[model samples]
Target: MLTRQEITILQELAKQYAEIASLPIQKEKRNMWLKLNTIQMERPMVLIDQIPWHEMDVDGFLKTKVSDPHWRGIEWEMRTAIYRWHHMPADLVVNPYICLPRIAENVGWNLPFHAESEVGQYGGQAQTHIFVNQLQEMEDIEKIQPRKIIVHKEREAEMLLEAKEVFGGIIDYRWGGFSSHLGFWDFISLWMGVTNCYIELMDRPEFMHAIMERMTQIHLEEIRQMNELQLYDINTNICHCSQTFLPDLPKEGDIAVSGNAWAFGLAQLFTSVSPAITDEFEVAYMKRIFPYYGAIYYGCCDRLDDRLDIIAKLPKIRKISCSPWSIPEPFAEKMPDYCAMSVKPNPAFLAGESMDEDSIRKEIRRAIAAAKNYNRSVEFILKDITTVRNDPQRLWRWQEIAMEEVQR
Candidate 1:
């Protein structure tokens, strides 16, 4: 049973959430996303994610009142969602339901790696870490193990029951599988330092290939197990922070496969790697997994301007990320018509002591002009926002600028 304070807080938030979700604009935004995802021409969509919430305490709007840990988490979600909608609702769709995952523990994968970091003064989204290389030699690769998913059905049932008790009458509650993003090279870099990993690609090519092969097998097995356990969440509303409300996905009451959902792939560490080496190590392994998904969203922060041709060869490729590091003109000229360009403006502009509205506007306008020239569907995604200099107004103003540019 919940405390009276918890009940009061959650119920009030649920009612407000339900009211906002019931608005006609929610459906309109979803339909717009569907059109954009399906390669149909629609106005560009703008999204802001990876916010530095520790700094967004405007008049104590983000301060938590609940005492229970679980309730505190739920409270934060509700507060942030409502805050974003009110302040910068750029193509954000507030669904009418709250989803709790089927509680599961990841077992196996015995390989361990460690890192050391310096955190920000406020201790939230600002941090830098240097990974210690754990996989130091070829022999160490033998220690790699397959991962398993161990679902706690009883706990999931209990949580679902408790959520229903709190939110049943106010809004819908869904028990869903965990949504995941898949990228192998990033993990490899954590195990082997980035410089060492790059050296291995050149000096120890066969060793790198063997490691990739093993990682591929491990991931494929994990995906198969999740499918067997019915733990794949195909109805997820977002893919890598961009909307995923496409029309081709399986509808309600339909049996879903891994292919019925979107798969995300990236090799951010391969930013400076040559296309041939990338294809040999990254694309070769990723392609083996891409066939399992109905659609693919690929790349992050990696400058893919020269590598678009390499990326286009992957199966079911629907969207490609164009980071601030990438030259927008080359990407815009060469991107496939069917694939939407998920443009990420530089978050550094927001991290300054003050907002640089001019730089932000020029960067966004450049992307817009390039996309329009090629008749490409564009989605402006502002992510990796590690700091706002303790000023939430900067983010709010950034959103205003983004929406203004996209709308124009």
Candidate 2:
């Protein structure tokens, strides 16, 4: 149960959120995102990530005090959400109601893990030594089974009713898995260890193929089951792909299926592997998974400059991420017309002892110019920023520079 004080804090935040959502600019931004997503216009969108906040000072803003850990976590999230929307110049649409009581049907099963990292770390920015792999032997693969989506109806309803009572009118409640970042290749890397997985591709070719085949089956089955159960996941207005919103997507009432929402896939772990190897291990199975989605976003922080030929073959891939390491000049020249380029600028500009606005501005201008030289549809996503040296102003400044370059 929420305390009287917690409820008051939530109510206050909801009012502020409501004010932003009610802005006419919000709808304009929404329409612009729709245009950007459909590849009709070249409006550049800016998306600021939540990574830097982990190392920044948020003390002065977190005024709400809740003794319970869960409630305190909620308070902290609300504070961050309010701060980012109000401060950052990203192309974000502030909805009239905040999201509360969000829930997903627990797919009753667990992907066995052999190695693990400490929480709040290994967020893809830092590389760590793999210490575990549950599948140590070939026989262990049999333990992997198809997962079933277990919808806890009573618990989901109880939480929804409670949220409605608290801020039902002030904020909207969404249910089901609307956003997914689970790329089975990454899941494979997690279970098999990066080095071991790569080595097995050449050494134990048959074994690697077997594992990939099973992983593909599990992922496809999960998606099919979720849709069959009417698990609704709406991405129509959500910024899952760059800053672009999925305008023609499912609603909260529609059935949750891959055909209605955006699905993301990448093989960043296969960065060092040969394109042919990646085609067999990563793209081959991804072909099976990508067909299920209405639209797909591919590539992460991995450099895909050389592997573009292989990736172009995947189905329904609409946006490709041009990482900081990817050669922007050739990437701009080679980007396919059917898909938009999502550029992920190096996050290191925001980190370290001191921030370099000049260097940051230069790089942003260069990236933007490269995209324009080829008349490519592009969006700049500033993410994977591990730390900001506890400086919030750096991100704000970076956003300003990025937006300026976009408008230029």
Candidate 3:
């Protein structure tokens, strides 16, 4: 029953290396995308998911404690993202990813939808209080009452079942359910503030360990339920939560980047920590998490270039995210043959600073070609594309040019 499009998204949802990427976008252009009848369904927007917003007031947080608009908001965001996928092909294939802005707003995070900004930095997101910070807390963390974790995960499962029933075999739910944007470091930013979390990492390593341990415990249980229920999605913010469907999958060779699907999926991020610290502090923890998934993908916000040395350290990584900040030269040279290289452009492009039309076109072409040259499947994800949402022509032109360049 899932629309043909939903089915395509679902298929990727089931894959370990299901690619997650984005690109510049526009609202008027989005409206046009919804209107288009092209059903390649193979385009990015086919994935399923939901959004996770932390830092809500008691009323807002408890609202979901019962049943709240945040649940309903998931449906709203999914519809919009799915509609967009139908209109034009996206650079990075994205599943549904969304911010819990409305729920946050309703529950009193007081998030505002600004006229100039398609997405906002403040008031719209949540504050994540859970973490792997306490090593001793891991046991207690594992026992985290579903009552607490369900603050959001429960609603996600409900939506996933509903969507699955509505869409049927057309969509994939295994690895395509609810994921996180407020992952590891991002969540630390929510609770302690990025700078503060950073400070604690240095001044209070013990505190940091406790947070990660507990967070990891909570994450383990969260994944266990979703994995059993076939609902835990691993994309940022969330695809099922954020949009109506799963993101498009990784290109051919990208799979080799993510260590392995661990039990189900892998959570990778770019912490501002130095390479030495990464080796000392992060790599071991990261390695522990990899063996549990079916496929693995690596690199988050961090330059894939700097982290490449440790790539092999990831036992079964199937995909690697290539950032604008990351250099693909090494990937092209020594990348494991099985890994998928997901190349990213600057989200700042949406701001239209250095990313003028000619420049973006050139940049995309170069990126695409570079990926192809390495025999790596490439995805162009403009994570924050709302910058040009109000301007349809610009959005249309960008899509048209991107399609023209990449299709070749």
lDDT of each: 0.83, 0.72, 0.43
Return the top candidate by TM-score. Answer: 1
Q: What is candidate 2's CA lDDT for residue 168?
A: 66
TM-score of candidate 2 to 2 decimals: 0.90
Q: Pick the candidate with the highest lDDT.
A: 1
lDDT of 1 by residue, 34-63 (tens): 898887857889999888888887878778
Error of 1 at 200 (Å): 0.7
lDDT of 3 by residue, 1-408 (tens): 234554443344323122222333434333322222122222222111111212212232212211334434444334434434444334323432332321111121121212221344434442223333322233433432331222355555565655555445443332233333224554444434445556666886776666666556655554454444443333332221112111222233323122112222222334466766566555656566656554454555566565567665776565566667766666555666665455555545544533377777777777766655765544455543434423434444556667777656
State residue 354's C-alpha deviation in candidate 3, in Å: 10
Q: Which tens-of-lDDT digit does each residue in 92-189 have in candidate 2?
A: 77655544323445553266665566334433445565547666567777666777777667766775765676676676755535555656667777
In model 2, the runs with Cα more than 4 Å from the true position are 63-77, 105-111, 116-127, 176-178, 239-241, 251-253
Which of 1 and 2 is ahead in TM-score? 1
Give TM per candidate. 0.95, 0.90, 0.56
- Model 1 lDDT on a 0 to 1 scale: 0.83
RMSD of 3: 12.0
> Cα deviation in Å at residue 107, candidate 2?
4.3
Error of 2 at 270 (Å): 1.6
Candidate 1 clashing pairs, residues 3+ apart or interchain: none
